[model samples]
Target chain A: MSGTWINLLIDIIISLSLLTGTFFIFSASIGMLRFPDIYIRLHAVTKGSTLGIAGIMIGAFLFLYVEHGIVSGKLILGMIFVMVTSPISGHMISRAGYHNGVKLWDKSVRDDYAEAVKEKRKSIDN
Target chain B: MNLQIVINIIIALMWMFLSESYTFSTFLVGYLLGILLLFVLQRFIPDSFYMDRVIKVIKLIILFIKELTLSNIEIVKLVYKPKLDFEPGIFALPTELKSNWEITILANLISLTPGTLSIAVSEDNSKIYIHAIDIPDVVESINDIKETFEKAIMEVTR
Candidate 1:
């Protein structure tokens, strides 16, 4: 009897986690399509998808722990790797975008890098 | 190589033997148990620099999780809104973190958080240039970074 109750509880948790994960990933997709510029789209994917993947992994881990009583080293390691690497790739992409002269949106208010780039260019031309 | 890794491996082996199962599950449990044992032991050893750093890193991880959830909701709202109301800008924030690893961690944390990206460092390596999606007040955002991530990072690095 208690076993059945525990099984039901685990089922609820797994579904909830999976649903939340899917929602976040969906939001990331919408954001990628809707955002105005490359940088903003980058932000959407970096945060939304990372958290979405985390949610999915958490659900899988919990399901395994509850049902099979087996913890997965690979899942844990994969989560750690994703968390560590996503931001790095995001940083590199944005840095490259900036250096390649991608313009900010018209609504952008300030850009200190523009002045810095001009200063460097002036020095090189002199 | 390091004492910590060596100690963890020893503990993991002990777990494998004790469980009579040299499987991945045993190793995972053993690794976690080893961490807990090391955490407890580090308190007694005066030379243990790792325990405090580990605790601070865990704290920072919690902070990042909380911030990520909040920012994810914020971005969702922004994405679905009829019109985006953002004051996007690029600003330079001077950082006190001196080490390359520390700066890298800080930059990564900023890039992972809400509506902000760490674009580059100054030539002098003293300032981090950030692209902010919404900057109603630049000083306020800078202070927010300093108070949360910079301070949390300093706790781990120093």
Candidate 2:
């Protein structure tokens, strides 16, 4: 009887985490659509999706562990891989966009990078 | 560092074999015992114990997770807002991290947190160009990064 109750509790916890993870991913998609520019959209996709995936992975890990009584190393590894690589890819895309002169949103208040580049060029020429 | 890990693992395996149980809990108990043994004999160890670095690395991971969750909520709120009137811009942040790998980790951490994305690193590696979704105060944002991520990283590496 007690074992059945514990199992039911684990199921509830798993479902709650899975629901929260799905919500985060949904928010990422909405933010991607609504964000004004490529750079801002990257923020939504990278940060939101990273955390979203982490939540989902945690849920999956717990489910597998409780049901099968075995630890899944791959789930933990995949979580770490996503956490490490997402930012690198985001950085690459944004860096390329900036160098390619993709315009920022019209209301962007500063462009310190451009000024830094200009200063470097002037020093090289002099 | 590698030697310490190997010794610890050997100790764990010996414990499992002697107990005649190959379960994870048995291994974990043995590992803890090994750590205790190492801690008690730290005076003769060549350098700092590997567990010190392991604990620091774990602390850094926890800090990153906390920051990631907080910033994700902030992004969600910004996204669901009716109007997107926040200021977004690219700004330069000077970094005190000297090593290449350290700088890379810092940039990756910065990209993963808050409203900021690390767009580029300077040729000399002195500065990182970050593009932010919202920047109410530039100095405050810079200081925030310096205090949290940079400080935590310094603790881990140095």
Candidate 3:
């Protein structure tokens, strides 16, 4: 009875992890299509790609958790490491875009950051 | 506690778990070998000086989480809004915080936030240039960031 219950739990976790992976991929696809401009699209892709891959790997790991307990753990650690590092690299590219004055699509409208800069200057003057 | 030994133990345990076997011989070999590898690898790696600034590091992490959560919610709203309200522009937020470590943290926090991206950390490290989406009140946002986050970093690290 205990053996059957344990198997059921592992299977459920694996199924949930798969759902998580699918959601990430779906999000990435939507982001790639809907975001305006290369910069914003790039931003979406960067985040989406990292998260999507992590989710898929986690799902696979969970599925193998019963037979290979430690495998999932290492995969989780690797995913965390990638999650931390990949965005930094992606930002480097986005930063380059801003420096080059890449145009933003007007369809995307609320850029409050520009006024924020003026205020920062005012504070410095005071 | 010996850091080396601590690391070795972790490695050994990880190995035993990964292989999914509990043989005494396997555990003994893995434990010794991991310790040896760590000692050899430690010499090749140059340690950063900022390890001493634990408080600053902790503050940075807290700030990052706060920004991430807030920005996530903000972006979701923008995405779902009946009218698209996004004016993405590169704006520089000048900083008085001088520590290089803090500056790096600042850049990362910007990137981590959903609606904002850290574009550049000024060469002099005096300014952080970020591109914020639909920032309603700049000073308020900056103040909120500084008071709620940067101040903590300053307290601990500087």
Candidate 4:
């Protein structure tokens, strides 16, 4: 009887985490569609997706731990890998976008890089 | 680095005994077990900067998680709004951290956050070029990165 109660508790926890994870992921996709530019959109994709995936992984991990009593190191390692890699990929894309001269939004308040480049060019020409 | 790897492997082998299994699973168990054991052993093992660095790396991971969450919320709000009105710009941030690995980690951390994306590293590696969605004030943004990420990184590696 007590085992059943404990299982029910685990089920509820898992469901709650799953729901929350799904919501974050939903928010991420929505953000991707709505954001104005590549850099900003990249932000939405990386941070939201990382945390959303984290939530799902945590839920799955908890369920596995409670149900099987087997602490799967693979799941934890997978989570760590995801957490580490997403940012690196995001960095690569954003850097490439910038290097390719992807135009910033019209309302973008600053262009420090452009100004810096021009200054270097002037100094070299002199 | 050599000592750390050696300790990690021994811990992994010990894990094989505890779990009563010897396979790839032992390696995984060893890695985790090494972390836990090193964490405890650090207190007794005088001058063991090896475990200290591992612990610091773990702290960095925790810090990254907290910042990641905050940035996610910020991005979500911006997305949910009717119009995106952030002040975006690419600026150069001077970094004191020298190592290639340290610089890479710093860049990744910035890119992972909501508003900032690392664009380039200067030829001299003295500055990291970042494109941020909101840079209303240059000094404020620079200080934020220095205080939160760079400071912790300096403690860990440099």
Candidate 5:
């Protein structure tokens, strides 16, 4: 917060991966937009966005450390947690949606899970 | 539970640091805020309930690594075979575990290992059909896969 605005601008400009990181975030956003099914979208939302956002936030955080000397530990720590939890949470939500009887898109191939469960139950009951 | 998640975040921070990108303030704030936010969000998102999520995850990773190492060796041996070492096909492996988390871990572990792909898991979470690179002794391989991975999932998630 203490650095001059121009100095901060220079610091932000210099970090190359920050741009790359932004690019990943863009791809993730596009993936979310383009994917047809909730399941497919969940994959993007979880894996792509999680990694993308983590990269961007971490890149931005790196900029702060070099420029402002703020060396903000809290934000970096938050990024790590987000990286870990986001995918797990995302996967869980998708799984729940599947289990709670949300149907997959019609064009999707392989409903093996449904048949497997049905046969398993038939065997168990018999 | 919140406290545990916070601890998990702290542990994660140590990992990030090892990767050597440290915004000391960002790390601190992110750890606390991320855990807090995740816990708040957990309430609204409905999912298969997992009481032993952390343990289950750890167990899954360990089991997957073991399977990967073993399968890598298997792949190596098959590579040298003179007469096409495998007749690959898909088979359904019976699974009793119903938890979505556990089933996914099972599928992922299968997919992660060499020579196997978890093509499908039953919606009711009973059987998983996997395609093996070498469909040798379907029952035995299925058992090995289950014992190596699914059992661990059941033990932890149960």
Candidate 6:
């Protein structure tokens, strides 16, 4: 009787986590469609998706461990791999866009990077 | 560090063989015993215990996950807002990290967290160009990075 209760609890936790993960991924998709520029979109894709994947992986790992008593190493490793790589790809894409003169949203508050580059060029010229 | 791990593994294996139980629980118990033995014999060891570094690394990972979850919630709120009202911009953040790997980790952590995404590192590796989804004050943002991510990383690496 107690075992059934434990199983139900585990199932509830797993479903909650899976739903949370799907919500984050859905928000990321909305941000991609709604954000004004490339850099902002990268933020949505990288952070949202990374956390989403982590949530999903944790839920899966727990489900497998509790139900089948099988410790799958791949789920944990895959989560880590995605967390490490997602930001890197996002960084690269934004960096490329910036260098190629992709315009920021017109309402952007500042661009210290551009000013820093200009200052460096002036110092070199002198 | 390497020697300590080797000793620990050997102790675990010896315990498994002697007890005729090759299960993971037995190996874990043996590993804890090995750690205790090493702690008692610390005076004879050449270097510090490996567990200190492991604990610090684990702490760093915990901090990263905490920040990731908090920021993800913030992003979800922003995405659902009826009218977008954010000031996205690129700013240069000067960093104190010297080595390439440390800087890379710092940048990756920044990108994974809320509001900020690292776009580029300057030639001398002194500054990272960060694009933020919103920036009311650049100085405050810079200090936030320095205090949280930079300090945590220095604790682990140094």
Chain A only: TM-score per candidate: 0.89, 0.89, 0.70, 0.83, 0.72, 0.88
Candidate 6 local lDDT, A29-122, one digit each (tens): 9999998889888888988998889889999999999999999999999999998899899989987887788989999988888876677779
Ranking by lDDT: 2, 6, 1, 4, 3, 5
Q: What is the C-alpha lDDT of each candidate?
A: 0.83, 0.88, 0.64, 0.79, 0.59, 0.88
Better structure of 1 and 4 per lDDT? 1
Candidate 2 docks at the CAPRI level of high
> lDDT tens digits, residues B1-158, model 3?
25555666788888888888988877887887785676567655455222335546676666665654454444444444666556655566778778887776656655666666666666567777666655555435665665555676676665
Candidate 6 CAPRI grade: medium
lDDT tens digits, residues A1-126, model 4? 999998999899899988878888999899888877887788788888877887798898998899889788887788788889988887778768866878887878776677665666788899
lDDT: the better of candidates 2 and 6: 2
Which candidate achieves the best lDDT against the true structure?
A: 2
- Listed per model in order, the count of residue pairs whose N, CA or C atoms clash below 3 Å is 0, 0, 8, 1, 27, 0
Docking class of 5: incorrect
What tens digits encode model 3's per-residue C-alpha lDDT throughout A81-103? 76577558867887667546676
lDDT for residue B70 in candidate 1, whole number 0-100: 77
| Clash pairs, model 2 backbone | none
How well docked is model 1, in DockQ terms? 0.67
- Reference-based TM-score of each model: 0.82, 0.90, 0.63, 0.78, 0.44, 0.91
lDDT of 3 at B112: 64
Give the per-residue lDDT digits (tens) of candidate 5, residues A1-117. Answer: 656887767665656657655655565566566554555445444444444555567777777877578788876787667654654465456557655777766544344456655
The total number of steric clashes, by the backbone 3 Å criterion, in model 2 comes to 0
lDDT of 2 by residue, B82-155 (tens): 99999999988888888988899899888877788899999899999999877776447668766678788888
- The top-ranked prediction according to TM-score is 6
Candidate 1, residues B16-104, lDDT tens digits: the string is 99989979999999988988888777766445736567778899998877877877887787788889878888888888888889889
